[model samples]
Target: MPRIPLKYMLLPLGMALSACDKGLEEINRNPNASESVSPEFLLSSVLINTAYDYQREAYWEEPASAGRYITLVRNEDNDKFDWGPRGWDSYYARLSANREMMEIAGTMNQPEYIAVGKVLEAFNFAYITDLYGDIPYSEALLSKNEGIVHPRYDRQQDIYPALLNTLKEANNELSLLSRTVDATADPMYKGDALKWRKLANSLRLRMLLRISKNYAPAFSVMQEILNEPLKYPVFENNEDNAEIGYPGDIGVNSWPGGPLANAFAEFDKRKPSKEIVDALAERDDPRMEVWIAPVDDPNGGRMYMDDYVGVPNAIPAPYDYNGGSPHISRLSPMFNSNSHPMLKASLMTYTELCFILAEAVQAGRVTVAGKTAESLYYEAIRSSMRYYNVEGVADIRDYYNLPGVQYDGTREQLITQKWIALFLKGPEGWFDHRRTGFPQFTLGPLAASAVIPKRFIFPDTERAYNEKQYQQALVQFGEDRAGTLMWYLK
Candidate 1:
């Protein structure tokens, strides 16, 4: 369990080009490739490769640019608020792999592989829809026989319900699995069907809770999970966390930015944002120390008021803060160094589930959850501290005494704390900030507009390749601008 073999992990995690190779043959399905590879083997490849991409792109890159935890000292386009184009093209590649896995599983009559494919496909589509709003879903991954080269977009309103059902179906199948792949094939849960079932339900909870504002059925689902927690099987502790382990020996699996990306390098221009530093400092949260290192002033001492001084977001290059140059605090060694190869790529965690429950309670969506919102909020805080390897329960307890940190049974309180806990994990913090509008962020000095971006622009390829469908979607969503609101956001 400690050292997953290289077969389970990978040097270049997403090196498999079967999907691309098949596509080049002018069809989605390749008879030769499908016959050569077992569905169980393809399942392993899709799971690891998708997890690796999620860790690199979604976990580190997207959230870093989103201005929640880290800020760029280079002060380029993303920092300046001219958010770049984000098409689902790369994600579609993963989805293509997933569809092939499911198809193969069906032909082979391996229910376990089929169930795993459903779960992974659900995971990818949820991420895709969340980021892009309406996207090609029902008709996607059908370009081979259906001749759906330009599939129409599925509204977020329609997509969530379908995704929830898909997750539910996957959970049912996983629970009934009498046999599964080898432990190596299931690196995340080591072929534990129960754990896989838990992850499926937990992810369903996450999706339901996210769209609960517009979708009222979420309350009943939450209540069902609460009334039968054992039956539902959500993440109970850090042990059930959906994290990917890195081998640290290879380029793809190694930490994002590698060894020299540590605090020692001159060109390592990333720093924690001042917003996060001030928030953690205000509550005397010990995780602040775990996140970043103190800056070394030229006078041979740390001249900062706070131990770590974060760079301001969206500021122009050569930006000055507090009359000092941009020698702001760098990320902690634990986060950036290659030495910590086992650095868990967090997909979801027990802490996040707790906060979701806390928010649901605060919203009065579910009254029979046993524990109140306040109690779950505290548990969420404690779990986050422990997950980050923060020492001393007393420090966490002391944080609770602070007016800013105390649970006030308010949505603001729940989301603000949840936002803090989600720091540097992924775009969840930024996404929650958008949904609840809590933990309000200040616009960087070079903001693109008065308001923050809502959604990323559709990629140029979509416009060029799928112009008819792409234009139709743009008109439906009301002009694919950053300011345009998605259905969920509305």
Candidate 2:
């Protein structure tokens, strides 16, 4: 009787609505809206964006043109070495996502995600420091949490060691076999934790070797990884390569220069550079056919010794060089397609690792049991051939035996082969060129700069928004110019 009286009284008075209003904020919240995103989703997004950016830098006109892999026939700022301050915004965007992923994973106690995040962070940071010399590291991505809007630029020397340490820590954390990763989230290795571990160690090797000339302990750190197979496993074969494939089903996910993403005329403007084309043609490299198309003859006759004709880089009116567009070789038709099996965005590869090891041995930095510099050198070339699907087409040994192709225990030979294998691999060829000066490049007659660029100048955003920090960085580093040598080079 009492319960009925209260319920009936509230219903009549409209006080029953008060009960529904309790926790109304929770109930009124949109179920479709996500207050927080999942770590896996963040990870997946970061990986895709990173891969696409990397592939673009590798295959697109700017970096490729700068690295002498291709020549831009029109709008040739990069070709003329008229590079301004290149931005690191895209890299920081991915790094910001990666930083968030790590934070959420930390709260969730997901060690695997944390480890993967560390690896990615190290990778991105390495590139940033390598390219720009000094960058925000210790205080970076702290605006939301620590309120550091203008993070100090960390020295490249200091950043390199920190990156190497981060990779080491990631490798140790990834050694835990009980932890699981989302297979779908990992575009490069498909949830293979061990492969990620290999990549961490392999990338460590790359970083170590990159700074070996300047960094004293690089060789010893490299030795530790090389000697320990089980603990510090590296890429054993091409299957262990850290590469991602484009779905190519949509404009956003398609290859950078592919038909879906770029116009045919834009693609046509990028012709193979004489530096790379002549190197391949002289060696009778099968990859020449895979990477470049045969030149179309105007008079129904071949223009060069081979049908392939590459344009001179940094030359005046490059569009008219080698007798206009029709006479010059375009990139292979495979590159023009929306997607192809060979069209992968590589983070690192076993071919590169082999070349790294070969260089290490030749330089007497580290030794592999039962392996000589020459053997690894040949293996490096063979792995490259196999990676390109040109292995079975010709006897690899014959190519190896050719003059300038044989192992001579010279750094030039080792790095030159690496440069060839590093085609379309994102700034690696240029990095090696800066490091070793192998496959020597010359400035064209019309080049704007007296010397090849060493590192990119700091972006305008940094100079504008973070003026104080930018000034401080320049005081420590030097004038903000592309020709200024970074710490590693110094």
Candidate 3:
């Protein structure tokens, strides 16, 4: 009965414990899988996915067609506005990741990540509400925490204010300069808290201007932000634009229609719409060279005032329009490349901010001390030229002097330029068209819908699975069709 070693004495007990149910449960867990993920890890994934998805949506046919920027010559369903119930699965998936990131950041006491998360959340939700009208907001992405599988659809009117408040909260949190964010995790601003703050306020201004028509207080809140510059900073120049560049890593990371990712025919089918091509060509805008390619006349039999020609949207047999593909302008050759400095995924730009401010001033919403609508209008156009890297190629002043390009002090003039500046940025073009009715887009003879669709139909899956809530939501919408106007529009 000599003293036994402690290890040997516990060996039998340890073996017995391992064989028991409690120890077996622990032993069976996967060694490779993580029980938790860091906020930085989630931030990286969220940024990449959000940017990639948004860029693809912006550059692709759907929004571009609706915006009258480009038209598809083949598979022209979207061009015809033959939209069905469009699902928002990808938007919600990104939102779920963002929610998880924000939660983890809160537990870790990282206010900066939480602030960034708020901005991202607002951006995603804004797109949803803007596109589809009433959407699951307050109760969304809460399946794990509260098991709310069938979240109620929040009215667009209600959702807008909440989004504005969220951005305000983010701006306040980001003002705490002491807190830091991982630069590598942030692709848009690279851990620039001030830039994040700018984006929050800038986006707030955008939303406020959007709802100013219906919401009485929107302009007042917008005035408050503009009046307090330091407390609520906004994008001052192109340097502060919230945009992300593609790594051109081929496969998934490359530009959507980049030569490496898509076949030649796929890229060739998307011809610049006559609406945008004529707009650019008329003003001798240098951006046309950056955005549109000159049409090809191999036989030299076609006489053209400008080398560029565009296909009309919503028309039958668009592929054969303007003497087929050979005689119509395709997108600029630079677009076909895997990546270009000029082609980055834009969340928002100072160019857009300039136009927003101009519109606000024109509409008597807010006023700056030394600026007028005309001045901001000119700045907007100049910024667009610089953003497209065409400023050096041609003087902006000359283009501005052109008859139609000059500042006419009309809302139409202001928004039409904003529309041109917003090309391929996101759904902003379509959103603006829906909101302002600028550029006066006309439906073609062969258009499917008589009226320009205001919102997307609710996804069919919601009807199938979330029947009760879905039915309740339909009462507010009246009909689950694209022609139905959302609260914002109403």
Candidate 4:
């Protein structure tokens, strides 16, 4: 028997069909060509691709641009605010594979496999909707077979509820799977269904909190999950974090700009923004040292400065790319180095969950058995510090004693910490800033508009190919500008 590899990830719609035909031809006598590809391989490939998407690419784009977390001395398009419609065409491509995995899993009668697919489906949809407010949800990714090429765009308001439902139903299905299968392909949790279940519940909580400000019904959903802990287990600690692990030696698995990919990064043009460095410095935050490298200031000659400094966001050209200013710092060696191949692509962390719980409690959404908002807030900070091995227990305690670090019972405090903790994780910090308006970012002199960007423009592909649907969606939203506030923000 010949071994057929069944790897499914982000394949373009046209390419996917062509690949399927090729696979079918190769595996003669197998009418169900897809059966030659195991659901395990499909799940693994999707997980790997998703990790690479978040950790390598989006780390330097929307998330960095939105939060003023990193300064782009290279392309600087996102910096100068020359905003244009961004595409989710690749997301649709991935979803096609996702839909295939669901079909294969269903045919095998594997509830866990089906649940995992739904979770990924919901996650990608949520990510796209979060960035581009209204998007094609119900009728997307069905062009080749279903022939629904021009799918209607769904409102974010409607999309969020559907995503939440998908997650809820997925978690229920995951718990019902009794047979334990080898999950070596699962990089996030090693194919542990329980951990995935936790992630599902935690993600549901995250989505609910995201819309709770605008959608009151979300509060009820939050209450239902909080009311049942066993049914909806959340991240208990850093161990339960859903991060993609890297091999450190593998070219594909290492950090994007690290030493292994030196050609791609040339000592990295990306640096921490002044907003974050200054904030962390003021709080005497230890995480700063772990995050950034001292500037290689070329003042008459090259020399390293012990202090951390960063470039201001959205500044004009004639900028310093070669460390001309003493105030510009490079990224930390841990991130930029090739040695720490174990650097994870963080999807979600216990620290984030604690912060979410902290916020939920402040808003009277949920309550821990004996913990107060302050307790959870402090734990959240400690969990972040511990996760990164930034500070010792004593050092963490001392740092919390700083005037700004203590829990002030304000939502601003929770939001601020969460923003700092979410560096390079992709888009969540930006999303938080847009929704809460905390850890305030200033529009630089070169800003395209006076306001900070709220939502990403729908991709030009939609306007060009799916013109009617795109036009209807644009008209419903009023404008295609980056500064337009999304529904959730409103």
Candidate 5:
């Protein structure tokens, strides 16, 4: 399998179907080929690679911590300084590549293969739609096949339900199969069908809660999944985190790694925001010390909240901080020695599961007899402690005192902690912030080309090629305010 790059995620539509748009079209061209090749093989190949890109940004917490990045730019006390591509072009490429596998799966009677394909589609679509508002979904990628030149944008409400349904469909289809088939083609799990099934359920839970704001219907399913663990059992620990490990390619590592490592990062890119550092500092959050190191400001270079924050992304630094900054890279144990990010970013974790469970338990959704939100809260914290390898905090008094470390009676308190706990897990923290309006962040402004960025705009290529649908979708989006929320969010 070819290694995926952090800069460009997926293949384009033109490249997706150089020979034929659909699987059957290829067989139609050469009918005599018994088609010894199975759709599962093709799907395993494409899906695993796609997982690589999604996993990359997640591990480094690059874009999600943009909130931190923005703060860093402004010399604020609570953010960091890292930046990655933030637009629809990359996602469009990735989804295009991913959708081809979906088409291949559709032609076969292989339930397992189809289910797995749908699961991947659901995950990819969720990421795309969450990042950019109205995308080409209901009518996308089938121009030559259906002569449908212009596909309309599907409402996000409709998109969300479909994403969940596909996951459910995957679970239903996979459960019917009694035999264990090897899918070594899938480099991530090596074709373990059971893990795929669990992945589907776990992914379903993720999508279900993602729309907690606009849709009240998910509330029911969220409760249902929590109640019926047997029917919808999900990843319960770090072992079950949906991640893809890089095969130690110097240029292939996710963050601060490989050929790009020594050049792409200047050791100044990974500073910890006082907000995050302080929050952890209060708990004496073990991961903080593990992930960051203090800078040597021989001249008291710059300090605040008893800590230091990096300059904004793309801002030229005077020097590279001597390869020592209170950054994740400082925590060498989490990665192999390379200046770039790791490819093995955890998409979700046991800590996230426990946090959700804690929230559910508190809300009376899990049917716990007497579990209070506070109890669930502690469990969430504890799971985070274990997840980050932060052990033996004999004192909770100090943690309970800090502003960030304290648990206020607001939704912000609950989610902010969980968000910080999920570093390097993807832009989920941003997503949660958008959905819940938690933690009281000030979007303000960043570089001349950037803003708080409420949502990503549709790619220019997509508008050029799929003009009809793009024009129609344009009605919902205004010229300015890329950060504006979409219909579902509105």
Candidate 6:
């Protein structure tokens, strides 16, 4: 599969809307996720919309920013640079939407709906809780009709199991599906159920491994995928990438297209950190040109600066990297002029899979008998390079036979590359960095979160609406702010 469509593999890429135009107007007693069922169809709508929603706000935006950040200021968001504001209401809203969608699926007999919904919901929750800490999951949405209006928060440690199980069940249901309504409403896969199944398993692999250091159970899960590659095939190329579609039609396109009225307004939003630049540079990675745009150095040839750190998080005016300084967080070649970080987003990539497996072998988690992890590691390196369609680079196939090769045995070797692999993919890098503390990134003088934030703070909106419950969760993580540590981080 192609690493990315280099297009909007739009999140919620499952269906086309309009069939269920009423939307939750009539929650079916037993809905089928395909066809005209409002609840089922909304699954795609809800999720695909989220990718857009995330781009529009910081909570969703922050996962990537947080993963990449050392320090920075939000020209538009005082809450971001301030390190407070209940963290991200955007995630909360997304989660609430997910819960409602899933609840509808559950009320109905839509097997695929429950299956996929669980995984997508888990995917969303991972970002939320990981960014914030203890959130109202177990007790959330009770006000709809339930008794407890103030549900206590669930710990992040507890949340991981659900993330795993959700994916596991998703894969299982997908494996046995008789047929799904052409997924006419689906945008992600263009109605392809088989592909969604692969994505489900792929996601399971990622989630299990995400909490690997903390969850001893991850060992078996990893082993299962290795044992059954055929049963759980992962995206082999960029084309199979879990991506969101970009409209590119001005406001309807992505955030980078126009002036975002956010805190990063005066500043350009999201640029490649010196971390990304230097890593690719040191490795002689050819994709640097593709990854970053040259600064306006009238000389024509780009100049490398000495900061060793990086420039302001953004500089966006005059319709270019014109306000540019350093690698303004670069845009994918797929993007035209608007470079909004939200213009397009990735859920996972084949490159990331290669990196994870490479690390797994390098770490002795997956033994390839006599073969050292060197090849896998190199394969990962090359596969990642290939993803950007750089002009030239060696392919992974060559590494299998190369001699004098050695596994990047150091943790740094595994993580640094992993971080790079994760760019535009998922915030997995940010989570990984928080868990393992790699790169020991240097922060800019004005960066927010000072260090990469481990979790997103609860939304201040919760304080007003779900105040009591929010406070109770605050106690679980030891802080009310998004930065609080959850079960595993502690």
Evaluate model 4: give its TM-score: 0.90
Cα RMSDs, all models: 5.0, 9.2, 8.5, 4.0, 5.9, 7.4
Ranking by TM-score: 2, 3, 4, 1, 5, 6
Looking at model 2, report the run of 10 residues with the lowest lDDT sum: 1-10
User: What would you estimate as the lDDT of candidate 3?
Assistant: 0.83
Which residue pairs clash in candidate 4? 248-341
TM-score of each prediction? 0.89, 0.93, 0.93, 0.90, 0.78, 0.76
lDDT of 2 by residue, 45-93 (tens): 7777777777788778456876789888888788888779888887887
lDDT of 3 by residue, 1-490 (tens): 1112223332433343343476775887567755566788777777777777787887884788888888889988888998988898878977887887788788888878888999999999998888898899999888878999999998888999999999999999888659668987787788999999999999999999888889999888988998999999999999999888877766566677887768878888788889999888888889898999988765544444458988887887887776666778889987887778988878899999999999999988789768999999999988999988888665734787889888888998888899888889988888898888888987888888876678888888999888898889888877888888888777
Of the candidates numbered 2 and 6, which has the greater lDDT value? 2
TM-score, cand. 1: 0.89
**Candidate 4 lDDT, 323-393, residue by residue in tens:** 45554687888777644633677777888888888998987777777788899998988888887787594
Clash pairs (backbone) in predicted model 1:
none
Tens digits of per-residue lDDT, candidate 6, 307-358, equal: 2323433223312322344423443333334443323556767777766776
Compute the lDDT for candidate 5. Answer: 0.57
* lDDT, candidate 5, 392-485, per-residue tens: 5514444545565555545667887887777656677777766677655543233333434566556666556877777777676544245667
Model 5 RMSD in Å is 5.9
Residue ranges of candidate 1 with Cα displaced over 4 Å? 1-35, 260-267, 298-304, 318-327, 339-342, 391-397
Clashes of 5: 19
- For every model in order, what is the number of clashing pairs? 0, 0, 0, 1, 19, 50
Alpha-carbon error at 113 in model 5, in Å? 1.8
Query: 179 in model 1: Cα distance from truth in Å?
Result: 1.1
Model 5 stretches astray by more than 4 angstroms:
1-41, 58-62, 69-89, 102-109, 180-183, 253-267, 297-343, 360-372, 393-409, 442-451, 477-480
| C-alpha local distance difference test of each model | 0.73, 0.83, 0.83, 0.76, 0.57, 0.58
